[model samples]
Target: MSEQTDTAAVPTPEAEPTSTPAPAPEATEAADVATEVAEVAGAPEAPEAPEAVTEAEAVTEAVTGAVTEPNVWAAPPAPPKDRRGLFAALRWTAAVAVFAAVGTGVAYGITQPERTDIPGLSTKDDGRWTFPVLSRPALPAGAPVPQGPDNKDGTHYAPLTGLLLPAPEGAKADDAVKADKDGVVSADAFLEEYTPEAREKLKQSLEWDGLRQIAGRGWTTADGTRTHVYLLRFHSSGFVDAFKGCDTNARFTGVSALDLDDVWSKAKNTQMNSTTLDFPGAANFDGTDLSVYQEVKPFLGEEQTKIGCLRTGDVLGMVIQTRKGEVAPVTFHQSVILQSQLLS
Candidate 1:
């Protein structure tokens, strides 16, 4: 019993640190019995075994104490190494690259040529009047297009009135032409464009020529340029060729003589637009033959007149433009082209 008491007291110093945790009741009872046994037997308290607690155990106890109450006293870990400098440098490099690309693009754009210097982009509008969108009139159900393989005689089967070109945007209608609801005017009304003596001759020619109908439209533009477009439809293409109403020998009311338009001759030489005409006018049309004329210089009554004659299929298209000062070639050519499209 005395030996047991001394042995129990030998481990007491090591158990002192473990007292922070809950002590077993059996261990306490055993301790009490060993103390009573020691007092009754009059045994001496054993000296503590210093070697029982080596350096390893002491370190373990300290580490355990620190880990148990970590939040209470442990200093925060050192912050992760700062990387904002490296990240900032990468961002600056990317921004510089992007700006360099954009700047290069702008510099290239600035050094390029002007739009007008380019071949296809070199077009600009020259004083041409704006006409409505021109469309061909619809043909009758069973009729073929004029001059087609099936229509060898080149007969236009559509209504003559629908084939007449409408007036331009700002032009006021001329009431002098006297076209009926069917767009037909009498031979007398058509002859009014010629001198009284020439009218008599043209009227005789029209009466003998198989003239089927005459459809006319007239308008005066804002610039005081008067336009009269007339479609004289014949029985067939043969009759159209035989008619002499719009030919070079035809006489106009006030013009002394008519000659082939020099502007038109220059336009034909350039293939389409003539720089001499000073405007971009499409002066030619396929499937339609043209005989364009202008009144000779040394104006009669200080007025100029220009005429365009189109022979399309079985129809003879006549365009007359008169202005006090001078007739603009561009407007005259535009009117002829628009009229030719409707007949073609």
Candidate 2:
């Protein structure tokens, strides 16, 4: 039996275990490629949740309500008034008022007539010559009728005393009896008393065509000052203008006699200086021609001498005043003022 068993064991080869037939090389490589593909193509991820807000941010949003944009369609706010602009408007108003006032005054001045009476030398319009404080001299009782039939030419051959201005306070008529009679004289006769040069000059000056007559008076003051007044009448207003032209052109200063040798020298001394004379009134008095002159003569001790001539309508008037050692109580302007009043 032992022998038979040994023989059997030797004869039965040990059965090889069947290891999953050593996998094929190609199949193993295919499985490895499938695993790599799966790793490259990862699975799709899930969506993330939103972040939470803080408590402070939530409280601020609740307190200030939601902000909104301004409305572009609404009207804008009105602009503030400018204080400087208001002041400028007020200034413009005041300037307009001033201009209006000035315009009114200018219009008034242009429309109004020129005044006749001056302030200081006011005259009365009571058909006679009168002043504010001084009364006019009364006509001598039953004085000879003016320009009587005997003087048919109306040449003023009769006495002109009634027409002459009254004497100053301290002065009296030079010739009380013959003053009125001697006042009237012919131009030719009057020129005869002057030097030849003076006579010739006066002759040419007095050649005012249509001259009717001339009357004049002379007075000597206590201080050796001399005053002369003359009145001239012309036939027509044209003649008066011509006479004034000649009188204004003639120089009557500095020359001892009416000589034209040094006309330029004499002209320099005849300029009209400032005085109280109402020249504007005199010039406008019913269309008058007026002029004033200065005369200086050392021989007569006269430093201040003045003469004024005026022509109004058909009448001309002249006044001459001379001052010697002292200032004359009456001024040439006063004489002219009174004389002009009488003439007016």
- Full-model lDDT for every candidate: 0.77, 0.51
C-alpha RMSD between model 1 and the true structure: 20.4
Best by lDDT: 1
lDDT of 2 by residue, 164-218 (tens): 6656555645541123355676786545334455566566756746767777776
State the lDDT of candidate 1 residue by residue for 1-344, as single tens digits.
Answer: 34444444444444545434344343344445445445544796323223233335546767776434212122323333345665788899999999999999987865587655666766575556778877777888988998678987778898898889899999999987789977898889999998887888788878888888899999999989999989998877788888777867887889878999988887788876675444333554658998899998888878899999999888999999999988988888878877887787
Once superposed on the true structure, which residue ranges of model 1 sit more than 4 Å away at CA?
1-125, 275-284
lDDT of 2: 0.51
Per-model C-alpha RMSD: 20.4, 32.1
- Report the CA-based lDDT of candidate 1 relative to the real structure: 0.77
TM-score to true structure, per model: 0.63, 0.41
- Which of the numbered candidates is closest to the native, going by highest TM-score? 1
> Would you list the clashing residue pairs of candidate 1?
none
